[model samples]
Target: MEQLKKLDKIKVAIADDLDFFRKVLVDIFEEEEEFIVSGVYKNGQELIKNIFAIKPDIILTDFKMPDGDGLYVIEKINEMKYNIPVILISSYAKQDNEGILECLEKGAVDIIEKPTEQSFKASFDLLKTSLLKKIRYIYNNCVVLNQVKTVESKTTDYIAIGASTGGTKAIETIMRDVKRLSKTTIFISQHMPARYTTAFAQRLNSICSNGITEAINGEKIKSGHCYIAPGNFNLIFAGDHIELTDASKQIVSPGIDIMFQSFVSEAEKTCGILLTGMGSDGATGLKKLHDHGAITVVQDERSSVVYGMPKSAIEIFIVDYILPLNLIAGFINSISQ
Candidate 1:
């Protein structure tokens, strides 16, 4: 407790149309010395006007603001190139699973569902815990947004990708840079919630030339496409195609290790690429792939948002190359050629 007090309190900005809800956030922060309410605004317009002046470490905004919405705030923040993390709060019904994915794609680090009136006490307790935990996690592992290069390559047989935390953006960068190959099949296992994965897959499909789709159970994994493992299941390669199963009850959905372990038996002419993430989910699996004669690569710490996954793999001495985010696509293309 004494050590915690010595550390700087996290500065938070609140933007919502409801005066009552804004006060509720203030009151919650008042109870905890670890956080300080830096500014409170009634609408997105007000928050946008004084955002830089207030300079809060994090922002909590409602999905539907009178002047501008949460998406507007997020876009404007991105335009300004501020690394500040934003969290959106909405009633569960208002923002469906797709809407939640939209918020994440727009750059909100996380989302919180508002509790109902009847169960305010109990739900608010859970909400407070979830909000603070996400804020701290994102704050500690802030990502450095970087640009990547596009490259065309000869076709390879198979490629596997694992990422988490700030991985959505990283994956987007990688996918955008690579030219679609007719004979290469890409498998991605990104750490995400169940409902949001579908939207994420759709979003990627719209941007990349390669066909990107959410992995389904017993689907024939085809070449010239990218398959994202559904957030509720683990994507495993059974023979020539892919299968989704809930056999592993791991904490993180679409566990990288589970997917990587599945590649050991079918490690013929395979390449495993581990990107930025929070935990050591891909370490052991990547080691297995290496031991089974597969090319293994990890994103270096300098280019990663959170270096936990790659660092874990490096510590285990299984990585073939540690490359920066910008060079990863080129490296992949070179190896395939």
Candidate 2:
């Protein structure tokens, strides 16, 4: 909670139709020293009409609200040219639905999945804690980030990314700034449950300048569009296309090493970018890619929420450039040019 001390005393608003949820959320805020709950609304229309008066530091809203949904709240905020970051709470993480993604593109900062069990005692505590942590992160980021987009530069034929924990925002920022992504194929091995990966892909696509989608089995890797290896499966390159295999059996599906190994075999003359993420997932794979003539870059500790992945890569001498998130675009652009 030390990292969150700075966030105590910020204004917040909750827009959900459920009385129980509102009560629980208000209780959590009251217990926190820094959080001040300004208003609670039963519908999107009520919040939209009065939110300007509250001018909350952050907003937490349910996906389905009376009159309008969370997406509507995002739209209303954007229409006013306000930078209020709304976190959308949804009940699903499967089937690749675009409902949450739609709100993100419209200006929602993030989304979290609420449990479907309908038992508040089982889930409310976790939800409240996670939401509080998320709000603090969002507030700090807004203070530091003048722009939501990443800087743009050159892209290479080979790309690899890894993420966990706070990787969602990192991926969105990178994709938003990558205006000139090369036609070469890119692969990401993120640490997440399979059902959640689809949502993550959708979120990335919403903010990215180019295209991004969840990878299908035996699909050919192409340029302009970013590919995420399906959940619970490792993505391996087979000649020109990619394959997803059961990670539980092989013990490494959707893994950075496996993805890079496949790429190095087929395209050693490519570039690899390992962004913010947890664990040493990409370190070994990046070293192999570097050994095979691939350009390698890792995010710096300061820019990374968790420096494990990039730190391992740098220590192993697998990363040729250790740069900040913002400078990565320019560095690659200069070299690629």
Error of 2 at 104 (Å): 22
Writing each residue's lDDT as its tens digit, candidate 1 over 187-229 gives 9999998889999999999998789999988888787789999
Q: What's the lDDT for residue 151 in model 1?
A: 22
Off by over 4 Å in 1: 1-155
The residue-by-residue lDDT of candidate 2 on 155-232, one tens digit each, is 356667766656777777666755556665557777777788898888888777668899999887676668887789
- Which is the leading candidate under TM-score? 1
lDDT of 1 at 117: 65
Clash total of candidate 1: 0
Best by lDDT: 1
Question: Compared to the true structure, candidate 2 yields what TM-score?
Answer: 0.52
